[model samples]
Target chain A: MNLGGRHAVSTLNDIIEIPIDAEGDIVRARGTGRDICRTLGFAEINQVKVATAISELARNIHQYAGKGRITLKVLGAPRPGIEIVANDEGPGISDTKLVLSGTYRSRTGMGKGLLGARRLMDYFELVSAPGKGTHVTLRKFVR
Target chain B: MAAIANFEPAATRLARFAALRRALSQAESVDAIAEHTLAFVQTALGVRSAALYASTREDEDFALIASAGDADLPPSLDRTSPFIVELGASKGDLSKTRELGSMWGVDRAIPAWQGDNLVGVLFVTGELELEIVDELQFELERALTVSIVAMLREEELAVLAIQERELVGLLREVQERDALMRADLEKARDFQRQMLGAVPRVAGAEVAVTFEPLELVGGDLYAVAALDGLLRVFVADATGHGVRACLTTMFIKSEYEIVRSSAAAPSSLLAQLNDAIAKKYQSAEMLFSAVCADIDLATGATRLAFAGHPPACVVRAGAAAMIGGGGPLMGLRPRMRFELVELHLDTDDGLYLFTDGFVEARATSGEQFGDDRARDAIEAAHRAHADVGAALKSASEAFVGGAKASDDATVVSVRRVSPEEQAPPSLAPASAR
Candidate 1:
């Protein structure tokens, strides 16, 4: 998305893009997201939630897809907020519903991984197809 | 009128001057008072050299003490011509002008006195007119004594002050070192507390742990953690006491947290712990002795593993027996396998774990309290009280009574929950629990 312009720039809403790999490149992207939220005077509790959400999504990409990329940008003006987009071309989810279900579990038996990330953050969405891979996005606002 | 009857005023004055000069020459020793007298005579009479001599009466020798001369005699000038004649002269005797060059080199002699005895003499060996010498002798004697005494006192005080400063500096260094040691000890003590874990609250068990440190920092450690449907407990004693031992325990606890999530079996947990500890403490002389157990609240089944530790006692049905056969101590060897012993617990059965401080306590006669005595005390407490917490406390107190625990004393008690207590809705499913 073209979240660029003088008006967008003056609004103090910046865009940051990062490519992920096994070397943990997305950690830098997550840290940038937290810094952007903090600079916009977001609450510490909200900023931490956004940072953690970004980290979890980024880690999920590295773990499931082997490698991916993420984009974190501040959106809207006057009432500034954050948007995180993480996409990976890994083996597509065979059962998206089951993966998102609370009953589904990882080897650690921590079934609440995706559900927990959604609960802690303000906005969450997930889209995936069997052969096409997955796209996940999260949003948090300064207010 | 002068020719007929003349009284010479100049002659009378001259006589008095001669007598005073003679007295200076006969005076003995060159102490502060005598040194002052020589200085005064030199300044007032304008004599070039004035020296005071101290005499050895037994040897009839005189040694120079204070001198202002062309070449001062080395502090010992004895039985020479000038000194010998000067000593022979009695009080009030004076030597007339005599130039013996370097052999005697005396221009004049003045007697020095000590009470009525002729102690020594003062010699003036420079050109001075007789008139001025006669006039200045008395004033010189008075000033010399005062100056020498003051200079001597000043020298003594300077030496004393230097000594005092050195002592104060040494004391300050010791105090600074002591404060640093105390701060380090406090940090170690806080770390030890963190390693022991927060006091555990088991759903079906009453757990009471008391740690009595011999000092600010101690070597003993005990912890209880409820993780993954199992209650894990451990009590460890590191070799020696204080900072080094405390650090060993902390290292073990950190390693424990990492392994504890996956290892549900006691022997497996101990094996992992031993391998990690052996690698970390290979260079250290100290090692860890511990008993680790996993108790399932739902099944009342406990698996215990020991590594050269004092065995824990299980009190059930009015009888007590030690749990777990001992194994090699941790950190001693690599790849050492720990033996695991499993036991089924009846409701309300109690388990007691303690360090060697209890049984190893010595009496006045230097005999150990012994394991048998310790077992008897536990039995007595169990007979007196049904509650496991009370029994353990009473037993330890009675066993160590009046004798101080030479090492760190620690106690951990666990009691199995009855079926009724497990019936609560909050309890997890039997499989999960």
Candidate 2:
């Protein structure tokens, strides 16, 4: 559901809103995503992958942005997959190109979360610039 | 109905009062008192109804307790009313009351007292009268008053016993819950200790590490990588306490391993560690202070970096010099740059990579075992050529004077083993596990 003038993929009832502010909210965000994925007939392995991706994105927004939200939309008909979006007003990635090119892994110890999330899902789109904010949209088709 | 005249015979009046006492002697409750008093009033003075009013507690005013006969008597006695004020002023003398009982449709009321406090009152509707029997009337009131006080004392004791039982039950519940929680914590502490793995033996150096968590589980962690020719030491202190902080350490340990062997520089390893936490928990306010030092065995070159962590030291000839490479904390952001401290140590020198918990330990006099004292303790050990871990730990304990540790402390000593001091190749690194 579109809370504002943003893209409206599903109605209010079909969208699950998880606001990530504290540590516990990150778990809740992924748990909700996993449950929805399972109900949509996702395979057990896919369920785990989806859940891990949700955790990565939610944790990203929570730790770096300080505040953000994750919305999961259950796609229907032509495409049956869960569409997840993470939105935040924190310091956005200045080099979006480098982040996806696998070089942004000057990270904790290994793979950058964005790169990992990108590989897990079928469709991934990231939009951002310095000082503006980061918006990530991801979808993995059941087919 | 039987009536006693104003000038009834003294013997007759005395006999009636004695009989009333005998009737109420077996009464146990307020209801029994009402029943016996009403019967006595009906047979002796021919009253139509009688009701008993009593205060439910010591602080309460009189309220309806029991009633018998015609039952049209006053329901209760309000302590604040003028009628009660005058009745209280009359003390136990019913003769001094000027018909105040008429306010609530009662002909006469008898006050029951336990010392100065009014425990109960007996109101009669139709008391046709014995005018003044003096001592006999006073004797009748005292008989009822004694029974009322005894009933109240028994009720209070019953309530106290019930409350005590409930208190015991709640205490047991709390103790059981505490025991379960402690068991779970013990399991977590054991898992954390197991995950620490081994204190690796570097091909060119001697390594000794001592770790102590303040609680059953803590955030301090250390992992030694001596798999390849290069020896990398990673130590991290997550920014919290207990299980949550321990979980952070676990995450860091796993992520650090993923990139530890392949990292180009010690600074790059820390950067990758930062990216792992920053990208994963970027939305959370989670952070950790860490120090990573990688030493080249062939060249004796060391690259050490600190991220919101305390500085490490280089020991040369019984002296220590502090080296700081302060940088931003890990997590809560992405792509953070960490500064590096480059140093070199040969066969005669060593290095100490430790957490702030050691220096921040406090004594009974509120004195801190600060940087200066820490360096002094390390130098003292170096001069004597004693075991660094044992000497430093004992020095800290002595300075703390038995005070509890406020945080987790980890000290790792790395020194080159001279060609003469190197252990035999048959003495494997697996033994350190």
Candidate 3:
């Protein structure tokens, strides 16, 4: 849970690691993410859902933050869940609480993308500071 | 017995009390009253010196009000000092005294109170019997209690009055600036309306345009330029709403006009326009989506070029198909290439072009009136023999019901009028398809 730097955040079991710097990278991340979801035995519908969630996060990085990293992880053994962690070193969000509650939207970015990603995932956690950075974690069960 | 003899007389004491009350009541302000109180105490008690110190607004420290000759007042009087503590606890008592060297020295401290609130301390230094000192304390306490309370009240009101005047001035300034901005926006809106151009009534085509800009002003533009017996249509919408976006549309209209003579083909025209925008506004953060199409009047042949805009619906022969466009948004990069899609338009076929606001418009349930719905609307409008712009608008309004539009909506419908409708069958030119 406490992944300090960019390298430590992604586990060795990460299915795919994408460096999103342009709009095309989002499309690439979405395609590769659905494949990983399919390999984890997620149903077709769930794979599309997981892929769509990855697309929004990746696109947000390309649009507002300019560049960031997205790591797709599939956990095993005791439990199985697809996790996506997006880290950005751009201008960080100051009010994570308001953003999560769906009350505030950034001037440049639409209010729907983050909330839409949260809706697709079974678990959502966000850690951010004004000038430091933003780290988002999303997970969906393999049902 | 010695203290009793120092007292002036019962009548004189009564007269002095009444005079003190009269002088305080007539005082105009806090500082004026403090000045009067200090002067009265020195002359009535015949003291060598006197001073008055009171708490400031924050009650953190006491500020000296008025002082006369060798008063020996402290530079700062903290509210937490023991002298202030005793004054607050006992309410009004002059029994307390601190030893500082004095000239005519029976130095006494008196507390001034207003309805149980301790306002300040009064200090007097003089040579007097205990009885005269007690009498003087009673008179000074009575005088200052009335004056200090009135002084604090008047001082508070004075500060508030000054702040109110300043606030009113600031509000007026803001209102004036807002009026000027609104006037500028109105003028800009009028200029943009002129750029939409009159409804085109060419010999072989029927063109109708619908434009609705949000009060905040969004960039939605349509230009119909005729060249070499061909009609060139250009439509563009900029990102975000407001004055900045509206200005971009002006630039697009002017650039389209300037390049008309140099660029003959649809693709070349779009490419030239993109280069002009990208070069001039490289740092403006203004991006736009546009589509350019030239329709030959004689052959009904059309060539379309696009720049990151929505697909245009080609409705012909009772079926509808969307022509997809692929290119980067204009103003983002220099030398961007737009691919030209060539299509043969049959007589009476309609080409519907619109901004994303039409499809992205949300219904009451938060569902977007999507591309499929737009395609369906266009097909229905083509069948109904009604205005395509009106049909699409009514359909979207019905879909959204009463929901407010989040962005400005625009539509341009160009239907190649059949040759039979223009004139008598024999009079129709051989060049008409």
Residue ranges of candidate 1 with Cα displaced over 4 Å: A1-143, B1-32, B35-50, B53-104, B107-121, B124-165, B279-281, B284-286, B382-405, B417-433
Q: What is the fnat score of candidate 2?
A: 0.00
- Candidate order by decreasing lDDT: 2, 3, 1
Error of 3 at B318 (Å): 4.4
Error of 1 at B271 (Å): 1.7
User: Looking at model 1 chain B, which ten-residue stretch has the lowest summed lDDT?
Assistant: B424-433
**Which candidate wins on TM-score?**
2
Instruction: Residues B181-266, candidate 2: write the lDDT tens digits.
Output: 99999999889888987676567887877787788888899988775567888889988778888998888888888888877887
DockQ of 3: 0.01
Off by over 4 Å in 3: A1-143, B1-149, B215-217, B261-264, B275-286, B334-336, B362-366, B394-406, B419-433
List, residue by residue over B1-433, the lDDT tens digit for candidate 3. 7545545563365367667646755654445556777666666557787777764233336667777878656765778876666656764333445332222153766655555666656677775555555554555456555554444444344334434544696699899999999998888776777666576567787777878776646688788767777988888888876787888777787887888778888889889988988898777576899888899988989999989999999988867788966578888988878898999888878888888877788988999888888889998888776777777777888899899888877888888877568743343321110
List the TM-score for candidate 1's chain B: 0.63
TM-score of 3: 0.53
Please give me the DockQ of candidate 1 compared with the native complex: 0.00
- How far off is each candidate at the interface, as Cα RMSD in Å? 44.4, 36.2, 24.9
